[model samples]
Target: MLLDTFGRQAVDLRVSLTDRCNLRCTYCMPEEGLQWLGRSELLTDEEIVRLVSIAVTDLGVTEVRFTGGEPLLRPGLVAIVAACAELAPRPELSLTSNGIGLARIAAALKAAGLDRVNVSLDTLDPEVFRTLTRRSRHQDVLDGLAAAEAAGLTPVKLNAVLMRGVNDHEAPDLLAWCLAHGYQLRFIEQMPLDAQHGWDRSQMVTAGEILERLGTRFALTPEPSAARGAAPAERWLVDGGPASVGVIASVTRPFCRACDRTRLTADGQVRNCLFATGETDLRTALREGGSDAEIAALWRAAMWGKKAGAGIDDPEFLQPERPMSAIGG
Candidate 1:
């Protein structure tokens, strides 16, 4: 493992295939999306695979996740997954997506060795979904969910962002929907990741409050923390049975101390944390024909300088220049 100065080992890597997304969600990007990186600015599939090889073989990374504005927007997504899966001592592969075009490619993705997926679906109400995402693609998302399950993506995780007056009232209904459909649901507290820099904690619904609302309808017991201590989400078994749910309390309860992941943006920058201000340029070196050793060294140096926490609660914490869409979610 690549150990940092704080004694934290980097064991997970999130690679953004592309910054382009099909949907324009209110919380993620602007109504008129920001200018996207040109095709030449993004990392080629081969370049991405090479980096993943170094992360797994040299740095001892055991898990890799693909994230994007919406990963499905990448035409070469399955091919990318295949390349990563072919790595010697292959790492576990997963993806996070908006699920807009997923229905069309779900089976192909599974055949390419994608182990699992997390689909971001905030509201189940069609009109509410339209209002939040600025698109009427809710049915497409639902179809994608069914397709994923049919394609054998077991325990298909659903990620829902909790906003105060937006979709927080449907917490129970969402949970009910997931439980009935054999989907594992996770509620994440809204963070300062919007392209508009309009995240207001005062208008955010916290993880604790979500749990309170959920508990009123169903019994929940905490899973042993030791089993998933390093994971971002705190999981629980709903009704003490087979069903489960998770709450990512990034705001009220920060898990920075145990964070073991780093991110690579679609534009080829390495970020130690999601909220990192400083970025190490890897694309320039790759395009300039820098050898594997040179690129790997640069990556190690960046990780070595990672801060202990994101410090979202700090008074001086400024919103990151890139939003979740540009930063790879």
Candidate 2:
């Protein structure tokens, strides 16, 4: 197990396939975008599979989530997912994407052993979508979601970040659409992970405000805390039973104490936390002919030094140099 000093074991691993995205979401990166990672810098398909295999067979990682600037942009995604699925003690596989090209590959991914998906869809309005993403691909995302459902990706999840004035009022509408469409909706508090570093605390819509907006449309009953386990989202039953909604208040309601996740960048760097400033380079070790046991030990050491919290509430908090796009959502 990847055990930290704080007694949290990392059973969940987030792997970034590439630092390239098709859309330019305003909250994640600038319109022009940051310098893309060189092809030679990214881990090869074989390297990714080997590391993930080690994490599952050697280490105790039980869940593997493929993330990216947009994972669908990776040319070898289906093959990677298929390889990872063949590992002993196979991990539950999922992906986090912008859903730009998901419509075309949703079936392929499902057939390749992908268990589910979490696609970012901030608003239902085409105009709002175009304004936020700086692209007119709103219909593509909707089609992608429908494709995911048709492909049997159970409980297809939608991740939405609510900005203060922009699309904040659409909270209720977003929830209604999710409930009606059988998709799990999670509203996240915008964090200081943008490449522009223009995040303002006051300008973010808090979890309280989100629930308050949602209250006007649907009656929500809080799920028991005991049932939440290590999941980041705090869920509530919509109208008393069955369907539900969730809030990932990473800024307002930190769940650091119960965090069970570890991250790997596209370059094969181990990130202990989402806001971590330091990284453990496993790629170099892998390229240098290090044994699997040696690489696993290095990963274990990195997680052991994870900070107690993200420190977003600290007086001297600093945003990570790498934006969410590079860091993998």
Candidate 3:
């Protein structure tokens, strides 16, 4: 496996298929969505599969996740998943989506060889969902969740970004809904990834606060962080049964030390860290007909230079030029 300077193995890769999204979430981007990359700039499906092949066969990556402003927005999404699935010594394939158009494509995606998915559903209330996402696709998200379950996407995880006064109070409610529906819900701490640069550390909800609120109504036993080994979410068993919950404290409790994932932007820049200010331009080399070994070497060099942490707590920390939508959440 490719290991960074800090001894963290790069085993997971997030590939952004497109920078276009269907919804403009309050925490993700401005009401008016930002400009997207040109068609020619984005990596072609064949290029994407070639890179994944190198990662799986050469770099020892075991998990391949497809992300986007919303991956479903990409027309060849099913084909992409199918390509990744064809890898020898096949890697686990998953996706993280806003769940807006998921209802229509969940079964097809599963049939295309997707193993699982993590849907971004911040609220169960229609009005609140509308306010957070700035879209009336609230029911669409719910239907998508149902569709995911029907498609046999086991453990259908729900990712909710918790802001101080916005959806922080709904932790318990969200967990209840997840438990009832057999969905594993994770509350993510709001990070400085918004396009509007409106992330205030003080206004962000912490993992401790979320646990406290949920503990009031549900008995949750904290699971060992090492159980998942570099997986972003910290796990917990809720109500002492099949129910469970997770907290991704990206701000208050950073897990950069054990981060094993690297990212590839839709436009083909390789990011070693989510908050890394710089990127290694793989697109330039790819378009110029760079060999697989050449691209793999560039990838290795980028991973080798990865920082010890994202440094969100650093006094000198600066947000990336791209927002979460552009970066692929």
Most lDDT-accurate candidate: 2
Which is superior by lDDT, 1 or 3? 1
RMSD of 1: 1.0
For each of the candidates, give the backbone clash count.
Answer: 0, 0, 0
The whole-model lDDT of each prediction reads 0.90, 0.94, 0.88
- Model 2 misplacement above 4 A: none
Q: TM-score for model 3?
A: 0.98
Ranking by TM-score: 2, 1, 3
lDDT of 3: 0.88
**Model 3 lDDT per residue over 206-297, tens place:** 89999999999999887876686787888888877666788998888788888989899998999998898999999899889998889899
- Model 3 collision count: 0
Which residues of candidate 1, in runs, are more than 4 Å off? none
- Please provide, for model 2 over 1-329, each residue's C-alpha lDDT reduced to its tens digit, 9 standing for 90 to 100: 89999999999999999998888888888899789999999999999999999899888999999999888989999999999999989899999988889899999999999999999999999999989999999999999999999999877999998877789999999988998899999999999999999999989999999999999989999999998999999999999869999999999999999999999999999999999999999999999999999999999999999999999999999899999988887
Q: How many backbone clashes does candidate 1 have?
A: 0
Model 1 lDDT at residue 325: 85
Error of 1 at 42 (Å): 0.7
For residues 41-144, write the lDDT of model 1, one tens digit per residue: 98988889888898898888999999997888887899999999999898999999988888999999999999999999999999999889899999999999
Instruction: Give stretches of model 3 more than 4 Å off.
Output: none
State the lDDT at 25 in candidate 2: 87
